[model samples]
Target: MAQQQWYKGAVIYQVYPRSFQDSNNDGIGDLKGIINRIDYIKSLGVDAIWISPFFKSPMKDFGYDISDYRDIDPLFGDLNDFDTLIEQAHARDIKIIIDQVLSHTSDQHQWFLDSRENTSNDKADWYVWAEAKQDGSAPNNWLSIFGGPAWQWEPRRGQYYLHNFLTEQPDLNFHNPDVRQAVLDNVEFWLKKGVDGFRLDAINFCYHDAQLRDNPAKPKDKRQGRGFSEDNPYAFQYHYYNNTQPENIEFMRDIRALLNQYPGTVSLGEISSEDSLATMAEYTEGGDKLHMGYSFELLTDDYSSEYIRTTVETLEQRMTEGWPCWAFSNHDVERVASRWSDNGEINPTQCKMLTALLASLRGSVCMYQGEELGLGEADVAFEDLQDPYGITFWPNFKGRDGCRTPMPWDDQHAQYAGFSSHKPWLPVDMAHKAQSVALQDADEHSILNAYREFMAWRKTHTILLEGDIEFIATAEPILAFYRTLGEQKMLCVFNLGATTASMPLPLSVVTEHNELSHHTGSVNQQLLTLPAFGCFYAQC
Candidate 1:
């Protein structure tokens, strides 16, 4: 038998550090806060915790626009506090996977500060710098994912610098060997600190077209791309020349070489390009690149079983030798419960069903914070909103602030769902209070407990984690698939609709797990019936 990799069957929990937990009675969550909750995360049975960026940042794009890669921001705590967190988490047997925003740096970063000063500086080539056209407009038609043009002209340097997101987040020029080495060195720093892996943020946007070519217009049907808004002008471009450069392959090799030295460490890239799925496939096509890559394909509003099956199958077919990571919710998009709901209301049954469905998939899994409690998008009003993207595209898009709210821990703790004694950075969704961790802990049937039970149960099924998946042909609302690894196989079925569904079965049940099966589900000989938002797991 081939030796198994630790991450192959691992489950990752993503935490937006600023909103996870707050210690020292501060309004914002800090590293100490995360340290206090280490035991709570340990109870989830997740293998690793992918903490979002807590590095030194001005909070322009939250921690995504990092000013320093090596230091922890004061709002999150100091380096010493983070060291304690790593120590405590390691003690609990939880691996740490930090969020690495390598594509861009905060405009305030010393590298960018020096690069923007003069074209002759040693750091001038560290960022994408281009001369403006004769009309004095942007060099090309590239637009920022936030709202306006991708190019920001620096008066001091007399050249436009590229920023795929907000102007404060300037794109890094990976074409510069020095820039690539610096990124690798920073990554190595974390590996030496005992981090198990890295979640590379916007990995494909590290390099852009050297010719400064204008992007062609995108077809009308293809509007949405990662963080770009439907109303934003950025949706009009195909984003071909601006990102997903071929040089990224070589850079990935360099990153992989560094990680291989750490032994057992892994790299998962977040790809956002014109053809993000294709980019994901290409980036992980060879073992030298990313160990796994996840795209925004499954994060959208599409919830039909057909769409889910097609997306996974398509990626599987396209990937020659790549492993894929699937996530339905993250800090960026709306909660999957709200986005995938049928009638615009949060259904706990549907929530439980999706949890089982996501876990039963073939690849590694990632569950966002508060998702275990079946929390939906927090309704942040205009006055309570903090996301710049939502603020820019108000009325049309409310921004990601709704999904970035603090996790509701307890109603009895304080005003902000036990997150902090002071006012929170973002408003807590009052609706989440009822489903808080304290309340759900006592209820065996609660989504919180269900997630725990399902995850614990899934660990026994090695086939479900590392097996090859083949989608079973079925009608709408009913998604069925078989996870097979040689003689070990498990047939998983889920009804994603509001109404009951039934289909004929071809496999016989060897053992049935009662804990995970919804009471509304049944299988008799050749017939299978499932209630609305029901599921059945049978070993064949």
Candidate 2:
């Protein structure tokens, strides 16, 4: 049999380009900035770096609204800079996975512009356009994720086009063979550029229901999850027809076929639907589809041992043929340190414990930038908010600006935290400076050092990386699982609470060696004792 793929259990670090660093003092990070910080990323011991969108865009929804799929945005850098970044990152043994927002493009894109011009235009059907209802309203009740109706009127075409996100981002018609080929050509462009893989953005949203069906209204209680607030109208619907269409499965096969031509290239899809876990499983299951898939399941306000176990186990049971990728935080949601902590405060121990738990999960991991320092969500004021989603929803949601703030590199660089010489697009939170890389590098017990140590240690354990996971039933605040591969078996347990807790030993195993040194827990006779937010790992 062929050997397991490199990305099967790899750790990927996500870099939000605009906030990672500002090499030119432009208050925004660029490709050059990522190249400058490539060594630092290497020090994290990650197998790859998944960069958020840096493609040419109108910046309406940041880089998620691509105007030119083949070019780099001038605000970030040119193709030369990207080539240099790829070279530098590969020199350090780190792979590059760029975000592919294939579901939509900025209204300013050539295809969208042409499609919007006239019904007879060559690209007229490239996007989802429909005739208005007799009452001159949107054809259906679909709503934009950014709020308001999903359909936007184009006077020239005299029809409303579908936009699942911002009105500026018109959904591409994957039903069009030309559109599918064009999107694949764009993917091939990046593949030829030598990127190791792609982090397919909204991969499940590529196709819409052909019948233009109206999404059923979700009851008030069921409307609160997947990063949408109860106040946002997008959360009011079941989101069935607008995304996760049945045809997306075949499109996934086409994408996988293209990647198969490029040996060692991988595809990691982002799936969010009414039942994201099941969709994630379906997208990654056949091996002819996505190599790995992740969802917003763990990246929610619900944080507990039971919740985590249920989420992981549910996917494990459903995903019998495909691998899963897990993440706790990303550029879109609140950082885990504050989101999971008591009273929204930063807890270094809890951060460490969560890191250990995530790494020990059954699949690969994606860690966002600044997670190593246990950074909390920043408090951006109303006037300072740049996220359109936050501006539309206001106080209750606050968009994603808090999590997109600049990374703190030097605690002593009081002005900009060493992120930029000038003011950043968003201000760096003062609380983050105290836990900067410069300060953490000097302290052995700091979250940054602990993360580095644990990641480095994790690389040596094959069982932890490629084993079959089986959860052991435990009470609240205590998560226990065993990872066994071949003749090797390792027990991973964590105390996710604030107080010390003990549980009967799941198995009779003496501690030959413990992987983490910063832990404050121990395994005693027929019992496992864990200090608050402590974790334990040992071979049986």
Candidate 3:
């Protein structure tokens, strides 16, 4: 067989800097801490690590509001420490993917400072700015995802500046060629540093409507989605004029051109749009665009078999040339173990089953940091909440802090569960302490071990890595699919329900390999009985 792309069948682990591991006795996780755990990361069988932003920031929206793309923030350590980390990771044959937040920057950024100073400054058009209406309201009906109008009144230039997120984060004006060149230069700095790839954060927001037209209102019945509360005004609009502009695709082409100069380097974009699947297809449809793109469809609360299958099938139907990356959980959402399955209330069979299920799918996968350990969502109280979005919605929506808690490493070193000796930036859930790596290391069937086992076993199946997927028409609780390559074919059957499900074995196919793992039910000559959360993997 010809060699497959390195990303195919590869699992990318996301490491949120503040929550992964802490060194220097500071409450925050840093570069040295990641270096210290390189071996641990390698053991999980993930191909690459996607480290979240660690650039210079004012900490308003954490590191997402970058002030300097070239400099490492003091909280995450200096550039030398990052070099050590890159070297260590490379030595282990693990690639490094850094998060690039090119859409916006902190208001403290030097370019924004100069742009806000005067109308005729050299960097005056570096950010999105417009004249206020006669009524002194916002420039248009654009709404910020964080809340309120997207426009922030800037007294410096006596105009309103567009901020899709926190006011401190001002969106860059991609309409200006100079701004686009500057962003490309920032990425080139990392490419020169020997980084393998990048995960572009909110790449679609790089450009917006040049006319500054007001966004149209959405139908009240279809008002809640994209990780926002139904009551949030941001959810009430169609957002046509504010974002998802046609110009974004050309900007992606420019990014692709720059990346082409760096061989072996790839780009992945995170897109959240009205029709994420369509946007994902559009963003990655050609060789001149993103290498792979992932949408928020799989990160939602809908866990039905139909939803999962349709979401994948819909994208597969629309996306002819684009490759996909699937992820169930991330830093911004609740943990999958808790969201998809009952937490401590139920056994971990479901978590292990999901792991195997995701590994057997068609696309590349992204694993959240603590997912291998079967970590559940942390229940952060209102008093300990740090996310501004959470504070705005309050009791109804507690925000992303629940998913951003510190990683638990050991039991003996439980001062903050070995994450940090000092108090962690976010409270470590005592519940997760019982599920630490040290404890799970001794258990053969732990979720962490299951992940390692399945990933290792997955390498033997060439079809699973690079194959076309076809889902068989099955019942509500059971999901069955076949993956086929040139001459290699495998059948993957899963039971995602709580009750036992059964089906007659198809006489046309033969089960050549009995590789079924984590099995609980029986498969006689004629009938296949699947227990709750059971999975069947075999060669046909």
Candidate 4:
């Protein structure tokens, strides 16, 4: 296998800070709490940990909207705590990749606050602002992902500022050289502090149409949810002019140049565009932009083998040198087990099989916290909802709070699963408690143990990491593929359905075989039987 950067096929574990651990009994997870868990995280065999933003923010978007890119949020702990966390993580051979919100900043940010003061201030043009139309309405018909108009009028500046998300999180003007340089400087600041890489948030939304052209209306039939409910007006537009502009390529080059300065430093852009897959390819193309990019392609409730095959194949065909990171769960969406579970019941064996399947995939893999325990979504009451998105579009859509609940480390009966002394930011479901890390730790056949075993096995196989992937077409339910490198080849088969499935192997090409069932010993045969959610990894 050819040698490349560590992140190329690395397993990145995402830690949603607030839900991970609480150190000071404040009920919110802090840096010290994360530091305390380094050994546990390292035990899982992940190469790196991608932390969700913990920068000072108003929590309007739960740290996605940043007030200070350099400092840690008081709720999460101070800079000293963050420094210790970084030192501990590195000591365990775990790289730290932080979320960088470059496209926008919290309105409380010093730059935005000054910009809002008046049009004459030096920072007035730092954010995207425009004069109100003759009718005293928003400058355009663009709508925010959160709700109404994307443009919010600032009385002090007498101009409408653009915010694709909440109004409090104003969009930065990437067209301005100074703005671009400032964001890059912030990135350098993290690099100086020993960060390995970044997960760029809303990367495709960095720039807009210079002429301020209105986005064309999308056809009613063509309209899909813009990471929001279909009922939200944000789905009405095609969003062509508002984001994913052609100019984004130049900006990515600038960012890549900075990353190139630090050896082993990589970037994974979160492309949130209407054409996310296409944008993903664009962002990572030619190896001069983002090192890798991921879209919401696998984050949805859809759990069909056909959907998975098509998404990967399409990106493979379009992607030249670009790489993609695949994730089934994150802070923004419901847990995959709960989302994909039929009628809300998931078999533990099936969860183990799924973990093996994800680890065997071609691209870099991202595992959300608590996913290894086969944790499902928590049912939160409307009265206790803290997510603005869920609160705004209640009844039809419960926001991301369900998945953002705290990690259960102890037994279902323990208080707060031993997470904190105080109440958590969100309630932990009784059902999820049974799948806590402590419970799984004791069970040899638990999903957490399966994850550990599969990840450890994966690290020994270069073919599973950087190999070329070729799909083995089957009728239905059975998804099979082969990963081939120089002279090594491995076959991976997964049963994506609830029933037992069987498939015939290509015996002509398979001269030798060894199965990694995890639950059982090797099964080297022409015909394979897969129980519900069974996965088989073998060498030929």
Candidate 5:
């Protein structure tokens, strides 16, 4: 494989900096902490580590609201610390993929500050600003994903500026060529830092409709998914005009052009649109855009054989040329261990099955921190919640804080679970201590060990890495698929239930069973019986 295409079929480990580890005992994870843990990340057998945004920010929406794109925030240490992290991680053959939030910037950003100063400032057209209507309402009916109106009134400009997220985060006006160039310039700044790739956060929201049109309303039943609860007015609309604009295609090409200049670097877009699967397909098509794209389709509460099959098939059908990346948990959603569980419980066997299924799919995969340990979502109380989104929706929607807690390093540590000497920003889940890396390292059957073994095994099978996928017809709780690469074929079957599942197979017996596979299934008389959450892999 070409060095530039290393991302294809690669496994990326996502490290949420604030929660990963703290090196300075300051209660917040820093770049030096990541540098200290390079061996742990490398041991997981991931090709790259996609660190969430640690850029300079006012912390309104955490690091997503970047005030300075090229500089590291003091809370996460200085740029020198980041450089050391890059050097250490690269030494371990691990690529560093940083999160790049391109759609918007913190209201405190110099560009937005200058733009809001006057109508004719040098950066006046940098952000999306519009004049209010005669009634003095918002420019249009577009809504912010966080809640309320998408338009934030700026007294300085005497006009409303569009904010697709928190009001403090003003959307950038990609319609202006200068704004686009400046964004690319910031991206180039990172490229010069020896980074391998970028996880483009909310990349689809870069451009909006120039006409400032109102988004069409959706039926009450359709106002679901994409992490928005029914109570959030942002879900009431189809979100057509506010994002996924046609102009974004050209911007994607520009990003691709810039990336083309740097070989061995790639772009993986995080797309959440009205039709995210279709948008994922569109943004990554023709090899002139994103190298790979992933959406929230699998991060949802729905988990079943049919749901998994259909989601992958739909994307596979629409995405012919570009690659896909799959993730079950991330900084934005609840942990998959709890989200997919029957009664909000964590099952180690089920997690192993999920990893096998995810890694066996057609494309690359993203493993969030703590996922290998089978960590469940933390139940943060209302008072402990730090996310503004959770604070807004309250009881009905507790927001993302449940999933953003600090990582537990040692179970014996009295306070902060060895994540920090001081009280961390968010409380570490106490239940996770038993599943800490130190504890799991000694248990051969632990989820962490299983993940390491499976990843190491997966690297040996090129068929599992670069093969075409075809689903096998199976009943509920049983998902079967065949991965074919040239003349090599591997049949992957999974039992996704909490009980033993039996199904008829076409073959009477499986002659070859790889010892490295985590299989608890048996094939006899053309009947396949799998233990709860068991998986079977064999040459077909």
Candidate 6:
């Protein structure tokens, strides 16, 4: 078989730096701490590690609000430390992809600072700024995802600036040619520094309505959590004028052109749009845009055979040449084990089954830290909450802090669960402590061991790596599919329910490898009985 692309069916591990490890006893994870763990990460059989933002920021939205594009935040160590990390990660044959917040910058950023200083400044038009209406209201009916108006009044400029997120994170004006070039230069700066690629954060929000038109009010019945709260006024509008403008496409082409200069470099964009699947297809439709894009399709609380099959099939139909990266859990949403399974109490055998199912999917996969250990969400107390989003919507939405807790390294209930000498940023859960890496490392049947074994087994299957997926139509709770590439074909059958489900195959296709067995029983003839949450992979 011919060699496939570097990213085709590859597994990418996501590292939320603050919770990964702590170096210098600062109680916060830094670049050096990540460098020290490169060997451990490389052993996971993943192709790359996508580090969440480490750029200079005020931490208003964690690292998403960037104060400087070129420098490292002191909270994440110095530039030398980042350089050392790149060297170490590359030495282990692991590529490093840093998060790039391209849609906006912190209000504290020098460009925004200069733009707000005076209307006549050289950088005055670098950000989205508009004059208010006669009643001293915002230029449009746009709303911020963090609540309140999307427009923040700037007294110096005597105008309201656009902010899709926190008021501190003012949106950049990609409509300006100069602004687009400046952002591309920031990407080239990192490329020259030996970075592999970037995970573009909110890449679709780079442009807005040029006319500054008012967004029509969205009906109450139609509103859902596409990043806006139902209680917040932001959820009342269609958001047509504020984001996902057509002007953004040209800018993507320019950015892709720059990345093309580096042979092996790739770009993965995060599309958090109202129609994420459609936007994902648009952003990755051609070779001149993103190499791969992921949406929040599988990150929701909905867990059914139909939901999973429909999502993959819909994207497969919409995306012709574009590639996709599928992820169930990240720093943003609740953990999958908790969201999909019954209150996160999935048995160990089921966890292995789920891991195998995810690894065998059609597209690339992203595995968050602690996922291999079957770690559930940390039940963070209200008093210990550090996330502004969670704090603003507390009692109802407990924020992302539950998923961003420190990684458990040891089984012993030591200080910070062996993560740091000082208190961790988020409290570690007692349940996670029991499932620590050290504890699972010794057990052969542990979730971590299963993940390692499955990943190793997956590396040898070319059909699973670059195969075409064809779903087998069946009743609810039984998801069956086949992955075929050239002459290699494998049938992947999964039982998503908690009871035995019998699936019959066509009699004519039965072969020597037709034996179907789960953790419960064996199969005979055309009937295959699958145990609760059981999975089987057979060569036919």
lDDT tens digits by residue: candidate 1, 1-540: 122277886789998988999897778988888888888898888988999999999998899999999999889988889789889988987888999999899999999999999989999999999888899988888888898899898999999999999999999898899999998999998998989899999898888989988899988897865655677888888888888989888998898889989888888999888777788899987788889998788898888899999989998888869888899999899999899989878898888888888878878888999989899998999999888999999999999999999888986445898999889999888888888998998898898888888888888878877899999999998999999999987888889889989988875765474656443587777788899998887778
Writing each residue's lDDT as its tens digit, candidate 3 over 1-540 gives 222267766789999989988998889999999999999999987889999999999998889999999999999999999899999999998989999999999999999999999899999999999998999988888999998889999897999999999999999999999999999999999999989889999888898899998888899998858666677889899877777899999999998898889877888999988888999999998788998998788887777888888988899898888788999989888788888874345358898888888877788899999999888889999999999989998888888999999999997447789999899999899888988999889888788888888887777777887798988888878888889998777778889887889876676556555443564456688677889999876566
Given candidate 5, what's the lDDT at residue 141? 94
lDDT of 2 by residue, 289-351 (tens): 999999999999888889999999999999999999999999999999989997677888999
lDDT of 6 at 504: 86
Go through the candidates in order and give each one's C-alpha lDDT.
0.87, 0.91, 0.87, 0.86, 0.91, 0.84
- TM-scores for candidates 1 onward, in order: 0.97, 0.98, 0.97, 0.97, 0.98, 0.96
Off by over 4 Å in 2: 1-4
User: Which runs of model 6 end up more than 4 angstroms from their true locations?
Assistant: 1-4, 227-233, 344-346, 508-521
The true-versus-predicted C-alpha distance at residue 396 of model 2, in Å, is: 1.1
Task: In candidate 4, list every pair of residues with a backbone clash.
Answer: none
The TM-score of candidate 1 is 0.97
**C-alpha positional error of residue 437 in candidate 4 after TM-score superposition, expressed in Å:** 1.0
lDDT of 4 by residue, 1-540 (tens): 222488877899999999999999998998888998899999999999999999999899899989999998899999898789889998998999999999999999999999999988899889999999899998888889898989998899888999999989999999999999999999999998888899998899999888988888889998776356778888888999889999999999999999889878889999878888889998898878999998888887678888888888888888868888998888888888888786688677777777777777778988999888888888999998999999998988888899988899889888999788799998878787888889889988788988998888788888888898888888678888999999888888888788878888776544334444443222457777777777777677
Q: Estimate the lDDT of model 2.
A: 0.91
Error of 4 at 471 (Å): 0.8
Provide the lowest-lDDT 10-residue window in model 3: 1-10
Position 458, candidate 6: lDDT:
82
For candidate 5, lDDT tens digit of each residue in 1-540? 569778888999999999999999989998888888889999999999999999999999999999999999999999899889988988888999999999999999999989998899999999999999999998989999998999989998899999999999999999999999999999999999999999999999999999998899999888776766668888788988999999999999999999999999999999999999999999999989999998999988778899999999999999999999999999999899999997778888899999988999999999999998999999998889999999999988999998889888886565777899988899888898878888888888889999999999999999988899999889989999888999888888999999999888766335465675466798788788999999988787
